[model samples]
Target: MTPPMTPVCAKPRRRRLAALTALAAVFAVLATACTGGGGTAAQDVQDSYKTLPKESGKPTDGGTATVALTPGLSPNYIYPYPPASANGTVIARGLMWRSLYRPSGEGDQIADTALSLAEAPAYSSDRKTVTIKMKDYSWSNGRPVTADDVVFSLDLLKAALKESPANWSFYTPGQFPDGVTAKATTPDTLTLELDTAYNPSYLLSMLTLLYVMPSEEWNIARTGGPHLDHSDPENAKAIYTYLTKQSESQSTFADNPLWQVVNGPYRLKSFDPTTGSFSLAPNKEYSGPGDSRLDQVDFKSFTSAAAVLNQFKAGKLTVGTLDSSFITQIDALKKQGYHVYGAPAPARFDPLVLNFENTTNNFDKVIARPYVRQALQHLIDQGGYVKSRGVYNGAASPNYSTAGSGSPYPPEFGDQAPYPYDPAAAEKLLTDNGWKVVPDGSTTCERPGTGPGECGAGIPQGQTIDFTLSSANTPAYVGARDIAFASQAKKLGVEVTIETKSLNYLYTNYGNSFAPANKDKWAAQDYGPLYLAAGYPSSNTVFNTGGSFNLGGYRNAEVDKLIEASTFGADPTVLSTEVTSLSKDLPVLFFPTPHTLVVWKDTLSGPPSSFNALLSFLYTPELWYFREQDS
Candidate 1:
């Protein structure tokens, strides 16, 4: 089966992605702003408080809203199909492009651009063939969006997968949407014939990731060459390569005729490469759900979260995420005439991932033991870490299941934490497993075998519990937590050495298979807080054996089975059982989910009331608008 097309916030191993900096100055100001009498106490305020002002009246048209983007991290790729970060994708695709469906605040999928273009999928009796009827929708260039456009986009994705497996997370090597064939049944209809029965929910969700492109404009013939047939492998690869090169060339974004055509609500108006800023104008021809109430939307990039907050304080930003370090500033932000609301807990989490590949100092022998992994989980001081890190209330809590607390899965699975903070429990687990523990010293394995009370196989006697814990050198808070964790582990005779590296280095050198030389260099890695993704939760990409993001090579046959079952849209009860089972397996040492804050000006209106805005904040910008000022 094809991997699900969902929004994933897994740690990327990119070379140039910038680290998020601390807003210490903002913290200092918040400390003072949140204290003193006659105001809402910082601790009393819930992080879930709605910050965006209520839509008191109908939305007023006109006026542009300025948004802030991380400086020096502007999106280089504007095409909707190619791979891009969530933030960049939101601005480049979510804002200017349209998909088949969008996520509702309530965490349900609702039709967006496809509300009129396509009908609910109809499946055959055998569930082998699914048919969709397409409606006539016009592109920005005045051309109709036809069935051919969808087929072309799918072919492009197939070709791009050949060139780069990293392009789509769901794409498996040597596979092409298994036994699937796209054919235009009529000018206004598209039929998808499948060779086997699959999960209709998953199949429909995947369509959201496949954005329709303009075949007439994106075709090879438009590049002054003969028309190339998508059916031909060589031709498809060539067209994909050409399109990819064009997408990578940031300078051509505004001038490219292939990019100018759009069927979405907004169109790119101007781009300032130097400032990493851009503007979007409403596509007058757009016939989607909501109208673009604003005359234009401007995105301004900032060097740091502090800068973004500064813009918010100065009334220069209409909408932006407030760093948690500045949580105490909520009262002050409100006093400054800004509407401060608590955002949902981030969908991502940072966990201490143990390397199971015995290649690293033979550390895998020790880490592979279930008791040892369990001990590490018990040693985590989740509460202290959150308090010290300034994560808001109800935001930080122990998480063990792969499905986040925010996922559609049942809460019982996510709420259960098999391992809680207990130094005694950690110590006993180590000692009972045949480890000679000396408090505040290094632990040495004394028994090595495949029996109860014996350290697992490949572990040699006298092997000390000592290894380095490396964390990404961004988000300043992660580094602090790493040190704290190492300090705590030391009390249990586990000598944890802390090392900080760039995010790119952590992903590429430590995580990805392409860099095997650096694989065994680090024993444990800190890639947490939270990793976000859309659709139903499945560990196929991150937890299954040999999965793409399975950085540490931690494999469990039971986990592999559960993940496979979950992908097929199996019974919720069975899926929940799988989640619960993994919760106790200690696949990775889970941590607390941090509370993310988003603040907007009182002047702006229409933010979604019940959505995973943290994962896809730019999902539907058309719904947002400015209110008319009172005389």
Candidate 2:
């Protein structure tokens, strides 16, 4: 769900902590263990960016590059504002879309579409108004990208929020436009006035979410034809529905006028629905850096990792991510003229999230108990799961906090896990809590109470520990991990029914609050390896009470307070303490954090030497180019 670790929430203020000593040792061991077959060669490549082989002469003007897309991956919505946007859609949009600031190779912001937009925004004396200046760039249709376009995009977003409140996770309804307004001071300047001061880093990072669109192309009524009257409720809903429907229907990519207008380096030339393959031709009118060296670039999708690897071996693909299953084959690939780069650890962490609002079977009452959640964590063989998953080698480690172990947050915040792999400890915790343990059958609550050896209130006697465990069907590894976890859980007298669902279904129907009926159906879900945006490790959208991505509906007054403080207060000590508290609280059972592995042909150049695989690679496709041939 959420395109394999794509974060679903809005930006929140991040926490900071100093470097941790213990974490460094653990990472060393895990990294060594995970890179076993491929030896130090792969790890060396992974630790830093490996430069592409240099050409002897000047670069050639034009060629076509072939890249790989995950199978079954297609953009259902090319527009970025929609809540249902996927990785495929983001990649497709990146080719034609232009944001005010693009992430550099090191994940720092640089003005790409906007020339010298703002380093640190100029705030008013009251610190409530932010003014930004735009660059002189033009759309493919030769219209200057102006401050009106920026203001228009925000207006469209505001209307979209009214139509679908769940879609815009960044701004709170009524609170958004209450005092916040965008004004075009000049054709090249747009000023944002806020009623209250917000965290500067959080506010600036949120700008990346805005993808400027030609108001002329999108803000039109179904029948009125080319009108920007979003102020009218009827017109706003109609325009949103029209653009959304057009994006969903991709029978012919080139024929759609809505998809033709662009500002980025590439334009869509062909799309094959049957194979999920598409080709993009360079935009001659593009104003960004690294002007297209390739005449056309084709993205090929394969049903399985094996299919992708096959193409790589045949030299059909110029660049592609090497799945964990193919890690051991790096040596062979190297001999075949392929350069492997250790993908930076993705910003995601796989966790088993228990629903706290399941009233259907009275299971919520049991899950509400802190001891029950803790025991479930102890019962999971996290180390074993990581080893058996066969992806990322043993590089994956047991994580407990919402912030990933590899995240920028200090390691000490997540260094200590409240629950480790100890079934005996698990059984003891349950037994001490009034759960009648039956090794192979089911554990039932024997004593309900507020005293020792008693279950929490509302949990009736004889309520068995049985619930369905749902996970994603693809990746093959997640299913394996779920099966193993269920088997291990059985040893603790826990009854788990495993159900595998598609990624989209898991995220939309089960994980998202928008799908209440489906959300109520599951007890525990293990699909997402949820991620946060680079440089921002805020869990406001995922863990805070009523968060859009708070799939489990967890509510803790203390956690809610801490989340609010971290966002508005921005105190590192408070943030560190909050993470430590969560580690002990065990809101969700966290699994190991896995490393991303990418391999490409030696002939390709221009990819950043180092970048966060999950967030950076796809967002900056224009930097990539083919190496000049040594003819």
Candidate 1 structure quality by residue, lDDT tens digits, 1-631: 1111122222333232232133243234224332232342235356435444456546788988887763224444576655522223223575555554543333333234343356677888776777877666678888887888877777777776666666665554433364678887776678888765555655665565567777777778337787778767677788877876667666667777777788777888887755557888888877766678889888886655677778888888887777665666777888886776554443344567777874555688778888888898888767655555233333344556655556566435456567888889999998898888888887888887778898778888888888888776544455556666666788889888766664434544565433345767888887444343444444556777766566678788987777666655425345556557666787678776555566777777775452235333434567777776677
State the lDDT of candidate 2 residue by residue for 585-631, as single tens digits: 77678776654556666666663442233234453445566667777
TM-score of 2: 0.85
TM-score, candidate 1, is 0.86
CA-lDDT, candidates in order = 0.63, 0.63
Worst 10 residues of 2 by lDDT: 10-19
Window of ten residues with lowest summed lDDT in model 1: 1-10
lDDT of 2: 0.63
Clashes of each: 14, 2
The parts of candidate 2 lying over 4 Å away from their true place are 1-58, 83-91, 103-120, 169-179, 229-235, 343-346, 389-392, 395-398, 411-414, 570-574, 607-617
lDDT of 1 at 302: 60
